[model samples]
Target: TSIRFCLDGDEPGRKAAAELMRKYYELGYEVEDCPPPAGYKDYNEWLVAAKLNLNRMNKRADEPVRA
Candidate 1:
């Protein structure tokens, strides 16, 4: 069985993730640590950025072609 943890991209988050991973490993469980992207501090920010990017792509796709 595997466990996934989504943590912030800051120091505290990193520390917590490390601690949790260590504990889980000691308990013989597979741990997967997921942190936000480089510029994002948390999952919500990353999600918002992703949504905006997707919207921009869709808008571009809807534009008419030019000669």
Candidate 2:
């Protein structure tokens, strides 16, 4: 099973994530870091952008491609 990480842009958040990453690394678990989108303030903004991206991808996948 894979774990999803939502990272924040703040200093404290970054530090926390870094420490967690180290621990995960030591445990040999596959971890992915989701960085905040450009122009975003925090995780909430990044989440919104990520959701939008996922929605767009789903819509595109459902559409028929033209030859």
Q: Score each candidate by Cα lDDT.
A: 0.93, 0.77
lDDT of 2 by residue, 3-42 (tens): 4566776777778778887788778887776667667868
TM of each candidate vs. truth: 0.87, 0.56
Summing lDDT over every window of 10 consecutive residues in candidate 1, give the lowest-scoring window. 1-10
Candidate 1's C-alpha lDDT? 0.93
For every candidate structure, what is the RMSD over all alpha carbons to the true structure, in angstroms?
Answer: 1.1, 6.3
For candidate 2, the 10 contiguous residues with the lowest summed lDDT are 1-10
| CA displacement after TM-score superposition, residue 28 of candidate 2 (Å) | 1.4
For 28-52, candidate 1 gives per-residue lDDT tens digits of 9999999888999999998999999
**Candidate 2 accuracy as lDDT:** 0.77
